[model samples]
Target: MPSFHNGAVEIAYLDEGEGDPIVLVHGFASSKNVNWVYPAWVSELKKDGRRVIALDNRGHGDSVKLYDASQYDIAMMANDVLALLDHLDLERADVMGYSLGSRMTAVLALSQPRRLRSAILGGIGIGMIEGGGPGENVAAALEAPSLEAVTDPVGRTFRAFADQTRSDRRALAACLRGSRRLMTADEAAGIAVPVLIAVGTADEIAGSAQALGKIIPGSEVLDIPHRDHMRAVGDKVYKAGVLDFLSRQD
Candidate 1:
């Protein structure tokens, strides 16, 4: 739970193992422990002789919380990732993210390609760049007075999960507000780095992984059949694909 300063925000991070570094960014309302530790991602990668670094993005986990919508921009959050790298003195590292984290990964790839050795984007697909994902509903749900008041199924589900995780609802709502910016196909295509798009075949929220893969040069898609957005996060197939991909890079 070591912390660093990304401007005014305090980012909490975990650094473990030793070798080529791999930075793990968690999804919305999830901390480094929930997204990577309890899921055994840190141990799994460490077993392969790789260093693992995970961080709590602003407004999530033990990091500084901000209610201002403008403070939660994905680009700014991406810079938080970069600043962590700088803090650790790493010039480049392989980065992996899920859901909202994937959007931040996209921003990282687009703005700081030189800081990444490779990128893995999970729980996201073409929908991220197509201008519609569950941000508004999820935000409203988070800000709702009660979970029972959230009528949208997707929103209710996310709200329940956020409650379960004990996340900061107001900060999360701000995160959702600032995270609506989407990347165009041309923007995604402009990234020059090894990329992996991992999504579940049954995930309606993820859109088409193949479509996104086709746009990013040297990108590959790993589809976990029979898994949806919630179920796919720690799926064995997804983990194996990611491990294999990382192994190939070494």
Candidate 2:
């Protein structure tokens, strides 16, 4: 694991393999290892001869923990990715993100399109515009004294995940509260880079992949059949579609 500072925040990351670069961003309460490495995403992409880079967002994983809600704005998180690219002295690369990371990737694609060769948004869909995923309830769950104290179904799910990940609950709570901003439909429509929006057919958290695809001009959608939000991350169908999408870009 290597790290660099995005201003005062230290971001921990892993860089592996070679050839064209592709950065991976993980979801809420997830570190790069748990979200990408454990799922074999790093290995799979590396096997395809890509330089795979993944980071722990501020307040998650081995990155510096920040308890301030104001510090976790989506743009601020997105800038960390930009900072990583700058640190590596690379001009542009493919960027892929899941769940919360998808939101960050969308911000980059819209605000910094020139920095992305392509964008792969997994575990996210129309929610990018419609604005619904983990909410204050999930934040409250992170703040709760214990996982058993959380009664909200969705909240409990996230709380349990945070515990399982051994993440700093307070820092994650602040991140959840601050990173709730959503992109406008106009913003989504403004993305010009090659984009692939992949969501599980059974993912209630991701909204609709087709709806988002229609909003982003020339964007493609991939449906991971019968998989739910959590189960869909490592699905074979999702990996195949992403690889196919990347191949077409080249």
Error of 1 at 75 (Å): 0.7
Clashes of each: 0, 0
Colliding residue pairs in candidate 2: none
The ten-residue window of minimal lDDT in model 2 covers 127-136
* Candidate 1 clash pair list: none
**Judged by lDDT, which candidate is best?**
2
RMSD of each: 1.0, 0.7
Instruction: List the candidate 1 regions with Cα displacement exceeding 4 Å.
Output: none
